[model samples]
Every structure is written in C-alpha cells, then in structure tokens.
Target chain A: MPDAPLISVRELSKQFRTFKRREGVWGAIQNLVKRDYRTVQAVDRVTFEIQRGDMVGYIGPNGAGKSTTIKMLTGILVPTGGEIHSNGYVPWKQRRQYVKTIGVVFGQRTQLWWDIAVIESFKLLRKIYDVPQRDYDERMELFNAVLKLNDYLHTPVRKLSLGERMRCDLAAALLHNPPILFLDEPTIGLDVVAKDHIRQFLKEINQRYRTTVLLTTHDLDDIEELCKRIMIIDHGRLLYDGPLALLKQKLLRTKQVKFVVKDSEQAARIAVLEKDGRKIEAVDHLTYRIVFDRAEVSTAELLRQILAEVEVRDLLIEDEPIEEIVKRIYAGEALKEVSA
Target chain B: MGPGVRKHVELLVAYAVQFIKVRLAYRADFLISTGASMLATAFAFGFLVVLFQKVPQLAGWKFEEVLFLYGFSLIPFGLFNVVSLNLYNFGNDFIIEGKFDRVLLRPVASLYQVIFEVFRIESLHEVVVGLLGVWLAASRLKLAWGPLEFVLLFFFALCGAVIYVAIFLMLTCVSFWVEDRVGVHPPVWNLIAFGRYPLSIYSGFVQFLLSWIIPFGFATYYPSVRLLGRPEFRVYAWLVPVVAATFLTMAIALWNRGVREYSSTGS
Candidate 1:
C-alpha cells in the first residue's frame, strides 16, 4: 500500500564480543590460560522505514551505534540479528549487487587512490561500476559545474585540501547515479565556506536526482538544512523517529517572549497578564520577559492583550535551541518532559 | 571474453597503470627498490655458486639441478610478490587504518579488488634473473626438451605461483582472528627459503612437511625432479596442480570466513 519503502529495517541488532584483559602482568599471565569476554550490544532491535526520495538524518551520541547502523546498511558489516532490505536487496547478503544501488561517503576516509590524480580515480570507479561512457561524461560535467572539481581534477588526491578531497569524494560517490546516498559526517572537518558549499551541493543533488539520502552527522546545521525527517538513537536503541518540526514542538514546548515596554505603566500592565502557568521576569526598568507554554496560550492572544494595554517598543520570540533539545533527548529526559 | 570478464581485466590494467604512475612519482625510491631486489637475487645466486664449488653435489642433486630448482622457485615467488603484496598489508593499512572498508564498499568482489589494487612492478626483475639462471643451468646440463615437458613446466610454474599466493592469503587471513599480529610476510619468506634448495638435502621428516603439510616443495623440488626425469620423485610430481588448487580453495574459504567475522575498526 505504501509502495514498499526504499529502505526497510526491522528489529535490526548487532552484538560485539570483546575480550576484557586483566591490567597487570600477573593478570595477563592468567589470561593466557583463561580469557574473559564481554558481549556489547552495539545495536539493539532498532527499526525504521525510509520512503523513496526522503532525506533523513540519523543522529546519536558517540558510541551510540550511529556508525554501526550505517556500516550494516552499506554492507560493510553484517548485523547480528534482524532484517534490512535496502532497495530490494538484503544489504549484507547481496553486497556486490546491493552496493551498486547506493552511494556511500565516509568523511574520515577517502575512497580515492591516495597517489593518483582525481580524474584517474574517477576513471577507475567508472570501470569498477561499469558505468557507460555517455553517462559518466554527463555526470562528470554536472559534478564539475556544481563542485568545481576541475581546478584539482589533475592533482593527486593526497595533494588536495580536506574540503577539496571531500568534494571529490562526494562527486565520485554520485557518479553512478545511485538511488540512495549514505553520508557519514561528510562535512566533519571543513571550514564555514566549505561546509556551506557541501550543504548546498547536497541539497541540490537530492532535489534534482530525487535520491533518498540518509545522513549521520554531529553538525546540527547539516541536519537542519537537509533532513526533514530525524531519527535519534541512544544506547543502541531508537529513541525517536519523526518529522524535525514535530520533534522540536513535542520536546520543546516553552517559548520565551521578550518585551521592551515604553514606560513603567506598560510593564505593570504586562505583569497582570502573567497568570495560569505563565511566567513574567523583569530584565530592566522597561524590558520584561514572558515564558509561556504555546499549547496553553497562543502568542498572538498574549501579544494582542499586551499591545492593547501597553506601549511596546520592541519584541522578540525565541524557541529552545535544537542542540538543547537533542541534549535532553540523549540524556533520557525528553520523554518524561513531553508527558509532563 | 564476456563483457563482465573484460571489464574486470580492464579494471586490473587501469589499477596497474595508476600504480606505475604513483611509483614513477618517487623515482629515487623506485630505483632503490629495484636495485635492492636485484642485489638480493645476485647474493643468493652467489651463495649457491660458492656452496657448489666446495662440494660437487648437495645430497643427491648436482650443482646445475640445484641451480635449476632455485631458479624455478624464484619465478613463482616473484610473481606472487608482484601481484599480491597488498594482501601482506592487510593488518596495518587495511585493518588498523580502516581502509578495508573501501574494498567492501566497491561493487566488486573484495578479494579481486585487493589483488589488483597495487602492482609491485619492481619485482619483475626477479623473474628476469630467474629465467637467466634457468637458461644457464639447462644449457650446462644438456637437458632434452619435448613439447609435453614444456607444457608441464608451464603449468607447474603457474601452479607453484598459485600455491605461494594461496599461502600468503591464508596467513594474512589470521589478521581477522587476532589483532596486533599481521606481519605474516616474514614467515612466508622463511617458507619460501625452504623451496630455494632441493628437498633431498633435508631430513625425510622435513621433506614430508614441505611436500605435504605446507607444499612449498611442490613449487620447486618436485618440479625440478620431474624436469630432470628423476625416477623416484616423478611419481608425485603431478600433485603440484592438485596441491595448488586445494590450498587456493581453502585459502579463499578462510578469507571469506574472515570477511564475515570482520567487525571493522573504530566507529
């Protein structure tokens, strides 16, 4: 009925068994005879579905299994349990064929040959993927225009800067025209201008190609600019999966309203309006702050009442920062805060 | 060839070309490595010559026969180094640095991709030196050559190379099980040392171990004995291809199992 989502993962899990060695020389000697191992559940029964042409952000704290999930989806790691069907193929089972349908960029590493020119690397990839000559040229032209890769096309990969290397990697990943793209911190160590260039290029590519993009990044700006759907995982479990706007509204309910009143009379009038769970705090003689739950009182109603009774000089409204909301979510407090 | 096979071959050629270009960028390093390999081969040849001067024969084998065995052994070992040296870097470059993910992410068989990623073209000089040594020995021995013998020699040399490659792959696959122990090239070097001389010189148990257990003897000693028309060793000379194929299959199986067990490094 839903056209079979492009990426369907159900109850996926991965467990890693790591040895716990003793600290001292005596303990090490004992370990030679008998070793102890501890099994860590890196990913635990996490489930989500991504429709075609959707751009989703996968975020979690460090060691929260974000990269582990990406690894399994890209067929680089096999899952310990559960099922993942990405573009009609089981990722780890049908790796060679499945990888042809998806493009992956790992920011920490370069896929290009370290000693070869950027163009030679692309040519090798074309042969490896068996992309036709015409399609390869077309993609190269498009990438050159968008990423401006021509400047460093003949330069060896090891000679390029971090931003230039990342740009080339992104272009290389998309040359095959895969239906899905997985970017793991594609802008990890980039400057402001470089970050903007990458973010814009990604936005354009998703729009023009209708590529389903699943991004894992610590940069909230990357998520805010590109991903409409957000999935947050913590402790190897999926904590939340929904629209970004809904997450912001659900987890962050309080809105701070700042009012600069013309006189003390106007400020006194604003104090009377602060009843029924609304909070009012004074900044200076003329400036006042009002904190209110959006669900309890509409900002427009409060503003209307204030404007009618007091002479306001200036006003500003601020919502909670997404960083703070995410922090709370990772802290295991968002659910309780939402219910209360 | 079918388009699929042609494409893979073309990819391998492209990788070779790129690697050559990279090597050329470091012209001094390239020259130094080639010179080092040449010197090493020359020294080994010198060692054999000096030993033969002291004694007319080693065990039951003559000087030319021993030289032929040593020369034959170098052909496969050199080829193995040229083609599969990257497999030796599995621990440091691939596992520790997490570069193996690049191999897995490609839309090709991981082993096939790695096999062709880098070509050690400097080792080709070893093959040249080996052919020269074999020609000199054969001319001195006045050996009778026939068409079937030539064919057997060709296949035996190929099977020998496959055995070396298989052994290297299997040894490197140990990295999948244990961390901090990927330097398998030294052990492989020691194993190849056993093949540079006739197995007849060793004790019976050592010969048995090399012939059956590890099969380095199949690559050199048995092939030399067959080429020389030695009667006793001729019976088992045909086992060269069999041993190569079996060991190669087992090595590939072990490598695939290692891939399945590969957890990858870091987050």
Candidate 2:
C-alpha cells in the first residue's frame, strides 16, 4: 500500500432490499411469513479519491447517495460491492483499526457525552482515543485557541448554545489528532455567524494538522470558504471534479447583459427579441433581459450587439454565478464540455 | 506501558475517572437517589422476612433457603446492571442517532464500549444492600464454605453476570431492525425480577423453557443445586459458556447484518 492515496474508493455501490407493504393485518402477517421485497440502487458504481490533507466537498441531492457514501467511508456501513481503502485499511473489513486514523463530526448529531461537562467529555474522549496525557493537554490547548472552547468548557453539552456546541463537537473530533476527518453537513441548520465560526476553525485545523477532510454540505458557502476543490455527484455519478475557480470560469463565460433603452418602444423590444427569442425577456418599459449562453456568444460579443441595437439610458453586465450553472448542469442542460 | 494493554487500561481508567467526576458534580442528587434506591430494595427484602415469619415456606423451600437464592441473585444482577446496562438502549441509540458511527471509528472493539463503561451510578446503592443481604443470608443459613466454595461461588456469580448481559445484547442487536422495542423486550428486565425466585417452583414446561432455551434456570438454579450438595447435570455446567458464546455470536452477526441494512436503506 506504499504511495497509495490516503483515501481510495472504486466501483463502490450499495443495494437495499426494501420490504413492501400489502394491505390489512392479515396481509401484513402473511407478508411477514413470506414477504415480497423490492430492491433500490441507492449508490451506483461511483469512484473517487482524496490525497492526504485535501479538503474536498462531496455533494449531491437527496437520495442521491451522499450519506451512503459518507457511511461507507466512515466504516459505519459496508458497501455491497466495491473497494475502499482509507489510511491503508479497508474501512468495513478492518473497521476497528481504520477508525483510529479518522475523526467524524456529523453536524446534526453530537459525539460529546451528554449529561457531562464539556471538559469531562473531553477527558473521556482522551481515554477512548487513548491519547497520552501530554498530547491530550497540547491538543486541548490548541483547540482552546482555535475553537474558543474555554467559554463553555465547564458547562454540560446539553446546555450549550448551538455555536458553542459545534465548537465543542469540533474539539471532540480532533482530540486524537486523526489523520482524516469526515464532516457530514457540518454547517446545516446553523446561523451565519455560527457557520462562519465552524468554517474558520475547520480551515485552521486543516492547515495546521494537514489532515485529509471530506465535507458534505448543502450550504455552498461552506464550499466557497473551506474547499479549493469539490466533487459534485448527482444521479450517483460524478458530474464535476476540479478546482472551484474552473467551475466559475465557465459561469464567467455566460454573463447577463441588460439594456435600458431610450423610451418604452415596442420597436426596441422587437429588435432585441429578433436577436434571441428564448434568451431575451422584457423587463419593463424599454428594458430588456438577455441571457447569453457562453458557447453561442461570448459576453463581449453579446454586449457589443446590445449596445449597437439600442439607444441606452443605462446598462449593466453581470457575471453569471456558478450555482446557476451547476443548477443547469443538474437539470441535464448541456454545458460546454471542459477539455480533459 | 506494553503496547496492547496500554489502550485497554487507558480507556477503563478514563471512564472510571469520568464517572467519578460526574458523580461528584451532583453530590446531593447522588446521595438522595442512591440512598432511596438502597432503602427501597432493602424494604422489599424486609417485607419478604415479614411474610416468611408467618408462612415459613414458598413452594416447599424454607425462608432462609429462599433468601440464599434471592440474595445471590440480586448481588450478581446488580453487578450486571452496574457494568453492562449501557447495552440496554445502546443499539437503539446507535441506530437512531448514528452514534454507532463512532463505534466503528475507534481502534478498540465497539463491543468494549457497549459492554463496559455502563456504570449505573443510580444503582450503586443496590450493591451495598446486595452485599449486606448476601452476608445476612449466609449467617441465617449457617452455610459452610472453604476456599473452594468461595471460588465456586465467584465463578457462579460471574456466569450469572455474563448470561444477563448476553440476553440484553441480543435484544440490542435486534434493535437494528426493530423500531419500537420498549414493549417487545420488556421480558429482558422483567426476567431479572423473576430470577430472585427459585426455578424449582415454576412447574412442567415453564421450567424447561426457562432452563434450556433461555437458560434462566442454569444461571441461578444449577449453582444453587451445587450449593445444596445435590447431584447435578455435569454437562449443564459447561452449557453456560456455550449458551453465552452462541448468543453473543448470533447477536454480533445480527448487528453486522443490521448495519448493512441501514447503510443501503438509511432508515
């Protein structure tokens, strides 16, 4: 396994034989005796890898196997088919040993011991992870500086504010200084300030410890703040995998060029309409909204035509956002394919 | 400081210290609750004495002999509660909150976390009374014991403890598929209450079912048979380990299969 990636997954898939309901109690009882079952392909053949210290966002819509992938990586669930090697250990086959190298923090759930003070929970974690006394103290000190856990160190986790609790959870996950961290929706349901605090702490830890991080979240802000690269999965397959800037470069190609003409004239709108039927929408009196598909016309060319066609009062050209492009990508609209 | 024992000892000591710290945090609550629990159980035993003063026998067993069984049962039952009771709702929590995720991540066996560190601080009071009852029963019965008897008694107690935990773990393993289990497996705890009584009185198939199938009979019944100096089924003594092993293996397999179901289904 020398020179092997820190995380490697190939042709991984999971199929569930879900039970079906019949009708009445008699039917239920009969079905119980010899039931009919239907199979669901939750995760189709999907593959990806993460080198050590990479913070990669894993994303997909609901039922598109986001959590399923995370579970297989964390050793919580064994995949029905495929290979996953993390830190030189098969996650499910050798779960006990593999888990020692990883820390997982699920934002919706907590790992801290309930009913105990945060400090006590930390001590228990120190024991569970078997970190030496010196190392535990050093990590606690680092966490104090990074996550600001001292504010609620003596308070039970149950009583903490959401932000404080997230900080504590972050500290708990890293006490062992695991070489890898898996964060499932770590910023979900958090206020902006709280999300920022967690995102900041994550960046600091990743930079300081060089730990590989696999983060899955719905908040795109998490991606912008923490990840340099992302793997976008949809329909149980990778749609895009690259640096964040490249996805945006495609969005930059397609910019919205709006024109404010001299007066409320149908001739100006007619002229604008003639240029592009589907892409142009009448915003108001002599105002037109034109969407330029980058492949059909460059932003510069679209602007030059709009300026030439209308006597303008005011005009604005805005760069299209990547979120909208990804939306288009997921909607099955063809993107100008990136050259490999 | 040897590599293997280091982690085991570290985790045990950590939990022990954490439990102590938790107990200290609510000293008044701990004292009041622990005192009430001790008193409540002692009153039950006291009530038994009152009833025995009048009738003198239950199903042909004398009051002192019944006390011997009752005392023996509670001490080990309390020990099981104090050590392994974390397993009672562990599987449900594992399935529901995905705490089992952490279980898979640690270097040590998840079984250790489920089986140990389960100290029921609320029931620490019961241990005191349980020991006291065992002493009182020994005095009342005037039982003779050499070093061999003491060792045998310890083994019997250990066997009871393992069997009790094994039953709960099987129930926990079932929670992977079972959503609401508080009703389905009330028998696990309810049976602990019945263990206080002798199996000899249950009569017919009830005795057979509890004896072999669930092995409630062997836990207390066989050891007491040895205590009575009666000829016993020698093969049944080995059966304790066999039953415990089989149930543990089955429960673990079910747990593995259940986790597989959860990953794909995400339910």
Report the error of model 2 at residue A71, Å. 1.0
What are the RMSDs of all candidates, in order? Answer: 4.1, 4.7
> What 10-residue stretch in candidate 2 chain A is worst by lDDT?
A266-275
* Candidate 1 Cα errors over 4 Å, as ranges: A22-33, A253-316, A336-340, B263-267
lDDT of 1 by residue, B120-193 (tens): 99988878888788878888999898898778877888888899888888988887766543375686568789
lDDT of 2 by residue, A178-197 (tens): 99999989888889888988
Per-residue lDDT tens digits for candidate 1, residues A1-340, read 6688999999999988877877776975676678787889999999999999999999999999999999999999889899999999998889999999999999999989999999999999998888999999999998998899999999999999999999999999998999999999999999988899998988888989999999999998899999899999999998888888888988886787888998777766776666676677888989988877777879898888778877889999888778888998887785743333
TM-score of chain B of 2: 0.86
Q: What is the TM-score of each candidate against the true structure?
A: 0.90, 0.84
Query: Which parts of model 2 are misplaced by more than 4 Å?
Result: A1-4, A21-31, A251-253, A256-318, B1-6, B23-36, B228-267
